[model samples]
Each structure stands twice: as structure tokens, then as C-alpha cells.
Target: MLLNMNFIVKALLGLCLVNSAFSARILFVMIAPSLSHHIFFRHLIKELSFRGHDVVSISPDPMNDPKLTNITEIDIHTETYDAFDARKWLETVQYNKPSSEISLMRSFLPLFYTQADNVLSAPKVQELIQNKNEHFDLVIVEMLMFNAHLFALRERFNCPAIGLASLDTSLNAMDAIGNPTDPNYYGSFFTEFSGGNLSFWERLQLLWHHIDFRLYYYLEYLPISDAMIAKHFNITDKTAWDLEKSVDLILTNTNPIFHIPRPKVPNYIDIGGMHMRERKPLPKDLKQFLDDSKQGVIYFSLGSNVKSTNLPAEKRAAILNVFRQLPYNILWKWENDTLPDKPANVLIKSWLPQQDVLDHPNLKAFITQGGIQSMEEAIRSNVPLICMPFGGDQKFNARRIADLGIGRRLPFDDITADTFLDAITDVASNPKYKKSITKLASVLWDQPTKPLDRAVWWVEYVIRHGGAKHLRSPAADFPWYKYLMLDIIGFILAVVIIALIVIIKVIKLLFRIIPLKKIKLKEQ
Candidate 1:
């Protein structure tokens, strides 16, 4: 009997070793604590596991899912930054003017620097790098993750890395590759939308911001990141580590159909619809409510960070008043219990299965803060939107959706019951909005394979190909000025100025000589 037990234990141990050997290991690093940002990568991770990849995620907390059998969680806690709590900060700036609000937000940029610094300095990260046996073939890191981690892993593990950005891929990541962001838009390299359509003042603002970003990167983020990498990895050769050497591919969560035309680098892949795939069963009660409601459901969520309950009293009252009148059954993602006045049409819950709700046939419209992930889901579900954008890129995303003719934008402060009613009524009654969203949905979902499959395939491709070296951008060797076309512009400007001065001098000399010759001839 003792021998039988011993034999069973040995067999089990052997099976475990064999399973570990065959499993393809992947390391995914994300810096987002907010649910919105984390949601963007959830499907991608699941898909990797589905494809038989052993996925390890470095995140602030473990994912709530029980079926994520292959996923291992690594804690990466970030320092609490004031800017991250935008809702609380906005309350402090309530009395301030719009310009003041914008200025204050800019001033708080240091918070991100501090947060990044704290994340990069975490001892766990250093320990992970030191564990020589736990090497990853490919490292998929969020853009907000310390850039130093990318550098250190490439130098230490000698593995290829890819960037996953929740926002539209900007110049910061694209410039690492050969692609350049457009300057006319906020993320654009040449454009500034001070108030839309480049004016002289707008041009100056754009130029100033461009210079500011470059300076901030060099003076603050780069130096701090470099120091962290050096300290963690004990590397002195700074020149050897470049963004290009570290990042082989960039996967942006932005659809090309929504963005303006721009040159795409070979290494940059726009896998926007990766997060929009169908989810499993919704909660029974929620699913039943949606099915029972003869009228379409109006889904309201302020996203993960900013709670609707935290809104100012007047704003909350205004929202409640609007909700009271809406005929549609409301699924409000209210984090707090006991709203002052509850409407019969409204069903308030601390949380809702957002994607599942969106996927439901009864969901008529999404009333949102226009977070990109939410917007993408709404688009995927062919649901029109009433976007009351709060802050940051929400405004930009709202405008984008409105521009696409699938939604309407209502400022949070200015939203009234009438406006809300009108917007919802218009979206529900008008077939065009639904038609447009349906069109976008088709475009977003028309890929040859599932987005998850594609994402997982590429991840494995990078691992199998030993870091996709063929896709690495050659431009990583260039300086910032060279990458931005500033160097070329500066040279051209200098040459033009010199030529103008030379021409002026020649004109003056010719005039003086001609007059002198005329006088001499007349006297003779």
C-alpha cells in the first residue's frame, strides 16, 4: 500500500513537469489599476490561454475570473498619485475657469512622473529580472508601464517586447518605430487643435506642446527611467539601450476606420477590435431584466474610476431628473446605494456586465463618459451613443464618435433633461444613427479571423520568431529632432534666411554701383 501511494505521487510530479515543459510562457505587464484600461487587455489574455499559452500578468490586483486557468498574477503596485483620482481633483477645481482647469491638469503632470518612478523602482520588478530561469520569450507591456522595464528586460532577458496602448497610438510609441503621428491633432506630430483648424496661435500652441513633450521626456521621464534601469540591471552603457532595441511591435487599440490616414510603420499593428469580442453568460437577473423590458435599455456608466455617485449634487440631480423622464428601461452603473430620488424606469446597480449588456439585443443606446473601451464596445454592438465626456481623452473620443455620425455629444455640466431626452429620442427614433453604428460595427468586426485569435497568433509569432527582429524599426537610432523632422526643418530655415540676407546685400550693391556708374557717365 505504501509503494502504491509513492508510485502515484511520482506519476503526478512527472505529469506536472511535462506540462510545464510544453506550455508556451508569456509575460504581460500592465500599469492600469482602473478597470477601464484593464478591460482592454482582458480578452487578449483569455485568447492566449485558449491558444495554450501560459500567461503571467503583472498587475495591481488579480483578475476576478475563475476560468482563467493558465494565468499567473504578479503584483505591480503603483504609488498613489493625485492626478489618477481625476474626479476628486476636478471637485477641487470646480470654481476654476476652463482655462484654469486645463492649466491645473497640466501642472499635475508631475504626478504621472512620480507614479511611473514608483512603479519602476518596485523591488519585485528587479527580483523578476534577476530570476534567470523565468525568462519570457515575449513581453507584452502597457504603454504606461515604466519604459525602463522594457529596456531592462531586453537587456537582461534579451527578449522582444511589444507595447499595448489603451489610447490611440501616439508619437511617443510610434516614433520608436519609423511611423510619425500627425501633428495637427493632439496625438498628431504637426497639428494642434487649440480650438480646431490650425490658426497662428494654435500653431504656436502645438509647437510649444511638441517642444514641451520632448523636453519633459529628456529632462524627466527618460532620465528617471534610465536611472531605474541602470540601478535595477546594473548597466552603465546607456547608449546601447534604445526604444527600438527594446520594443519590436506596437499594438494600438484604435481602429483605422475612426482615425485619419497616416503612415503606419511595419512593426505597428492596429488591432483595435481585440477587446470587442463576445463574452460569456450575463448575470441571470440582469439578463432577465433586459429580456423583460419591452422598451429598449439605456445603459449609463461613468466608467471605473469616476463614479456617477461622486458627481456634484446639482449634477446628480440633473441626471436624476433626466432619468425620471426617459421611457426606456435604464441600467445605471451607480456605485452607491440610495440615489436621492429613484425613478421606476431606472434599475441601479453598483456594477454591470458592460460588454454583455452592450451585446444584448435590447440595449438601444449607451449613455457614456466616452471612455475608448466603452465606445469601442458600443460601436461593436451597433448601439448609438449619448456621450457626456468628462475629461482627458474622453472629450476627443466623444468628438470622434459624433464626427462618425453614430453619436451626439452633450457636455456634462450643460446636460439638461430636455437635452438628454432629445438626444435619446433622436438616437432611438432616427434610423440614421443606428445605421451608421451598424456600418461601423460591420467594419470593426469584418476581419478575416477573430481579434483575439489574431492577437494571440501575433504574440506567438513574436515568441517563435525570436522577437520579430525583422519588424524592428531602423529609425530607433535617430535623435528626437531627426525623428520629428525638426532637424530638417531647422536646416531649411537657416539656409533660407542666409540666402535672403545674401540676396538683399547683392540688390543693395547693384543699386549703388548702377547709380555711381550713371553719375560718372553723365559728368564725362
Candidate 2:
């Protein structure tokens, strides 16, 4: 019996060792200033910490989670630059140019660089780099902006680097991983084209944007970001352009089931709904609102970035005016307490438990900005949406919503009381909208593993394997002309031309010989 007990103890110890093997020291750099954008990384951090891994996160808004003992938080303040300023983009939208989004990105890159540079230059980051004792198994970076700067962290820790895209339809991340971005298959996040099989004209437009985007990065974004990396990291051996190509994996925030279907490299893992969770109890007030609504509730939110309160007086009135006409009880996520004429049916909250409220059985419709989070929540809950996009991929997501028959997108400039009223009525009254989203939710939930589990597993897989270098596509090494097959096309064209010239010369020589032979025969 004593011998048996000894064996059992040894087995138990082995089990403990096996369990402990999964734990990793991970470095996460999330410099995205936007609150909603930060949530994606926050969920990833939380998941890693729960799995008994040690996570050191550098973020603008750090989650001071006392529960996760292994997680370390380093704060970077970028509220001034990162905070959702609707006014800036709203003015750009007024221009009605397709390139307007590109212009906004150009304006925002300076501020994005400022925050990235500040985080790298922070004393804590510097100390971490200088400390020889500090080591990490992996480094994860949000690839929204400042990919180059975060790569510096990967080198500092001497570990594998993984990029997590903050938004869905990240053409930049797709391009960086050497994933094909053919206009025939993929739509620009700026456009509302559901680009599965695009028309000739549609493909041309997408191609133009594709070419312009490569030019923009090569000419503008990369050079400036390289300067920031050069200054802060003090490394002469590599430029930012070089570091950007070295990422081991890209954790994309996209679900092909919900997104425009396109080819992705094996390294680009889709963990789009990674943040989705089992429903928790709603806040007391929110619960009461849903409980009290006999006719069901309409939840309206522009996500965290675009403040509904930032809407101009006329726009605000237009939205409020629609809510007044709706029969169902309205729950609008207004940033401010007071609005001009909030009807009796409408209830305004500074912040609402968005996921919890979406989970409510009493939810008839969601009036949302086409933020992927909001759309995912609405889809997960199997509720229909009325998408009035503010900026960024909201428009793209909105278009997908409409294309999928899950929602309708009406532009803000054209969003009158009648259009808003009609959209709410159409989505709410139609059972097909709810049905379509429910079908999509099934495919989203029907993954081999839960998104969070897949995400954690991939993260640990990178750790266990030391790095994901094998998954790296050879395409990243190719220049534009080579990757696009332009060189091969040029070579093929030259060969064909030379062959035709040889054939023509042979025909001419044959004719000359035949005529001379005929003359000789006639003389004979």
C-alpha cells in the first residue's frame, strides 16, 4: 500500500508538470488609443492570464484586473490623440470622396506615431529592455498602427513576434503577411462592396485602391514610421520595413463566414469573435429597462469611438426624431445625459452593458455604427441591425450587414427621420433579418474550437514550438513586380514576339527560294 501511494504521488507530480508546461511569459504591446479597439487585445490578455500564463501588457487603457495575478500592466496615455473624435471624420465624410478615408489615415498617422514613440521611450519599457534577467517566450502586437515599433520589443525580449489585427478587413495586415489582396476577391475596407465575384468596373475600382494603398505605405506611412523606429530603438542594423516582414503570425479579427470570403495565409489566423462570451447578468437599471419594455427594446450605439452626442444638433435631432416615431422602447448609448428632444419612448445612458443588453430576449432591433464588435454582438444574439456607419470599417461592415440580409446601412448625411424610421421598421418587422444573422452565428460558433480557445492554443502553440517560422509565406520576400507576375508576363511577351519574328523571316526566305527555283526551271 505504501509503494502504491508513492507511485500515485509521482504520477500526480507529473500531471502538475504537464499542466505547468502550458504557461508562458508573453509580452503584449497594444498602443491603440481607441477604447473599443483596445477591447480586442484586452480579451486576448485576459484569456492568456486565465490560462496561468504570465502576460506583460503595454496599453493605453490597462485593465487593472486583480483576479489575474500573473498579468502585469504598463500604462500609456493616448486619450488626447486616441479618443474617438467624430467631428474630424464627419467633416471628411462631407467631402464625399472615396480617398477621404486615406486622407483621415494620413492625418491620424502623426498622432499614432506620437503615442507609439512615447510608449517605446517610456522609462518602464526602456528598463525592461535593459534588464538582462527579463525574458519572454512571445511578444504580441496590435497591428493597427506602429507595427515596426512593437517589433523592436520582440527583438528586445529575443522572442517570437505575433501581430493581432485590431480591426476586421485589415488590408494592411493581409498585405504584410503576403496574403493575396486581389481586387477581384477582396473589397477595400473603405468601400461597401461585398467583393466575392466583383464586376469588371468594381474590380477596377478595388484595383486602384489596392495600388494606391501599396504606394501610400511605400511612400508615406512606412518611411515616417521607420524614422520613429530609428530614433527610439537606436538600431542601425534594420529598418522598420525589414522588421515588419519578420512577424511569425497574424491573429486577424475576421470571420470568413461573416466577412468577404478571401484567401489567407496559414499564419493569418482568424479569431474575430474572440471577445464574445457567455451572457452575464445585465446591470440593474438595464435589466429593468428591458423588463419594463412590453413591446421590446431597440438598442442604439455608435460603439466607443464615435460619440452619438458628437452628432451635430441637426443630426442628433434627426436621430432623436426617428426614435420618437418608433413604437418600441429605445435605449440609445448617448455620451451625454441631455439631448434636445429625447422622446418618452427613448432612454439615454452614458454607457450600457452592450453585450448583456443584446442578449436580452426583449431586444427587437439594434441601431448601430458598423463597428465589428457591435455587429458581432448583434449577430451573436441573432438580432437584426440598422447600420448607420460613422467612419472606418463601420461602412464596410454595414455594407456586409446589408449584403447578408442581416441589416441595412443608411448614410448619416442621408439619414433623415423617415429613413431611420423605415430602417428600424423594416429590420424589426422582418423575420428574415434575424434568421440570416442566426444562420451566420451558427457558422461562427461552429468552429473546431471556441475562438478564445483557438486563440489561446495558437498563442501557446507559438510558445511550445519556439516560433511559427514554418508558417511564414515565401511571398513576403518577393518584391511587387515579382509577386504580381509582371516579370514573368514581360518575359513571356518577349518570347512570343521573338518567335513570331523568326516565323515571318522563314516564310519570306521560303518565298524568295521558291521564285528563284521557278525562274531557273523556266530558263531550262
Candidate 3:
């Protein structure tokens, strides 16, 4: 019996090994110039390589890890940044206004075209495309403002492709995937209004914004992208819009904890915090600072794109004045080497391990620019927030954070020492903020599978099945009129109008006949 059991165990082990050996060849393209964006996607790329799949990654930031044997990194860092200067663009942001969310779709149209053309025209990419031997089982491209990368799906690789976003799904992406964009219920990511509890006027504004943006995207933006993509790929057959619609799946960095809950097609998956991992040990000075802070620490950062050094001198002084009076020790992610009149209770660093710092036991609250990734880190660490939004979905994130009772939102441009002090002290001392975030963290983590695992599984599922076409919503292929059933409504209205006309004519004819009959009777 013992001999038979040993043989059975060996057979089971062999079967498990065989199942784990399944791997796919994937083409991953992420050309966005922002490091925060790349940081979120890097987790998936490394995870796939570790699982033994062969991955060719074209990205601004490559893993460059010698141990990632299965990954072939093609660096496009210089090409992308040269086309779009992120820091210069950020410096131009208007911070003094109540609404910082500008019309990026309109303002950045030329930059998008430039970026797409530059990446596609790069020599490395050209060689990869020209090489006839190059093939892939699946293709994954960043689905942000640029669509030129999608050309690889049909023009080059001729395989299944997936769209990935480092932020919440934008209006353009929602339309591409045939996901429902109910203006009344679901506001666009760029909009300041959160989904629920909108007044009538707000709803109308949301509706108008939705229609105006969609029309601009289809009529104006898409044509430019299509032209650039066509020119680079040397393709005459299909437009860039066609390739975007053909994407088998979209993996977005969004979650219901902070995002508005809405209906989604099977192909769109939320893997928001996939980049989050086990916290690492903080550097010696940083660890000592946090540990020694008897009153607790407040972490502040404006994310990768926005720099604190770019703040107006007056605004900087106002912020410092508030920090000087606060009892809490402050750790600010300052970009510059020096902060004039640096407070005794404050520590400034050009860079910090954000996640590790947030997880510290001495952390009281986080004062942030309210980027989605920063919010996710704060929530995962069960830390409350004081959100001072700078730009680009930060306003919306701040609103949601306040609505959820996990934090407070303050205007960055209109900051005063008194208001800033109030926000800091309220969030740091309030028990409700801690309780709300703790409860939310529990809900956010109560998933059947870890987000990264789910993302990898879906990527492999596409390879295994040769595409997730079966999961694609029919709404994606439907024209605007057909999807909204407007054609059917119009047909019904036409039939009703014709029937009313015929009935009125019949009544008039009967009246004439009855009057003629009465006249004949009188003559007789």
C-alpha cells in the first residue's frame, strides 16, 4: 500500500508541473513618458516573465533586470520624452483656478500626434516590424491618449491584442470598448463630478461635456491619429479606429472602492492596485525620522508629473507657514534641494519610497495631490488623506475621497494658512477618517484573486483561446444609432405618424358623405 501511495503522489506532481508549464509569447508596448504610469505596468511585465512566458516589452522604462530571462526589453525612453516634454507641460499647469482639469483632449491633440509618429518611426521599432521572423501570440499596448501602437495588432503581429490603462477608463476608451457611458450616472474620468448625487444643472453640464468630447474625438482627434498611423505603418486597408475597436480586452487600473460602480463588459477588467506589493524596509534616515516622530508623520507628494518646486513663491510660503505650526512631523516629496525657511519639524526628500512610507506605524495622514495611484497606496496602508488636487483626474479623486469620508479635499490654488492648518489637524486627529479608510481597505482587499494574478490570467487566457472575441460586447460593433436603439425609435414614430394621417382623412370623408345624404333626402 505504501509503495502504491508513493507512485500516485509522483503522478500528481507530474500533472501539476505540466499544467504550470503553459506559457505564451507576448508583445507588450507601453510608450507613455510618465514613470508613475510605467511603475503600475512594470509589475505585470515582471510577473509574466517570472512565470516563464517570453515577453518582448517596448516601454519607456524597461526592467533591465538580468534575472528576467524571458523578457526582451526594447527601450523607447528617449523617443517618447523627446516628443512630449512632461515636466515642461506640467509647469504650464494653471494652479490658481478652482478648476484645474483643462481640456487635455483639445490642448494635447498635436502632442499626441507627435508622440505616436515618433514612437512608430523609431529605428528599433522599424527593425522589429521589418523582421519577417518576428511573431507574437498576443499584443498589449498602452491605451492612453495614443493609438498608433494599435497598428501592430493588424499591420504587424496579426494577433490578439489587449489595451491597458494606468488610470480609470476615459471617455474615448469607454466608447471604443462599447462600455456604457451614461452621462447622468457615470461622469467622465476627467470631470470633477463624482457619479452619484448630482444636481439637475450638473447633470446637464455632464451630458453636454460627454456629447461634445465624443464628437470631438471621433470627428477631430481620430482622423489625425488615423493619418499618422497610416503614414507610419504604410497601411491603406484599415484606420486606427478600426484597430482600436478590434482590441480583445482592456485592463484598467480602477477599483470600486474609490471609483463609481458601473456596469462593465466581460472584456474590461479592473486590476487597479496590481502594482502594490509587500512593503520593503525604509532607508535608515527615513526610518529613523518616522520612528522618532513622537506626534506622528504627515506624508506629502504631488506625484511624478507635478512638482512642488513649481509652486508659486507666495503659495510655497503659505504652505510652509502652516507646516511650521503643526505638531506633526511632515515628510514632503520636494523636487528641489532646498526649501526656503524649512521648518524644524519637516523633512524634505527629492524621492521617497511612497508605499513603504505610507505603511509606517507612525503615519497619521497623507497630504497628497490625489493621483489615483497615491490614493490606492494610502487606502492599502489604511491611512487617511487630505487631498489638494493639482490636475488631471486629481479633482475627481479628491471629491470621491471626501464623499467616502476617508479624507478631506482642499483647493490648491486658493490655499490659506488657516484653511490648510484646519484640513491637516482635522484629518490627522479625526477617528472617523481612520475608521472609514480601514473599512474601505477591508472591502478593497476582499477579492477572490489578487489583482496581479487576475491580470496575468486574463493575458494568458487571451493567448490560450487565441483572442477574447467571444467575450467582446456586441454593442462594440453597433453604430451609435443602433446601440442607442434610435433607429428603432425613429421607425416606430414614422409608423404612428402615417396611421394618424390616414385616420384623419377617413373621418373627413365620412362627414362629407353624411352631409350629401341629408341633402338628397331633403330634395326627395
Candidate with maximal TM-score: 3
True lDDT of residue 89, candidate 1: 45
List the candidates ranked by lDDT, beginning with the highest. Answer: 3, 2, 1
In model 1, pairs of residues that clash are 182-188, 182-189, 183-188, 183-189, 183-190, 183-191, 184-190, 184-191
Residue-level lDDT of model 3, residues 26-102, one tens digit each, is: 88888878888889999999998888788899988787999788899999888888878655554555543323233
Q: What is the lDDT of residue 302 in candidate 2?
A: 78
The 10-residue segment with the lowest total lDDT in model 1: 187-196
lDDT of 1 by residue, 107-226 (tens): 655665565556656677656877878777778878642344355666676678887877675445665666755455444311213234556666676666666655555454566566
Q: Which candidate is the best by lDDT?
A: 3
TM-score of each: 0.83, 0.93, 0.94
Model 1: CA > 4 A from native? 1-23, 64-69, 77-106, 117-123, 145-150, 185-208, 239-245, 279-281, 484-524
Q: How many steric overlaps does candidate 2 have?
A: 0
lDDT of 1: 0.71
- Per-residue lDDT over 413-472 for candidate 2, one digit per residue giving the tens place of the 0 to 100 score: 788878778888999988998898899888877888777788888998899899998998
Compare candidates 2 and 3 on lDDT and give the better one.
Answer: 3
225 Cα displacement, candidate 1 (Å): 2.0
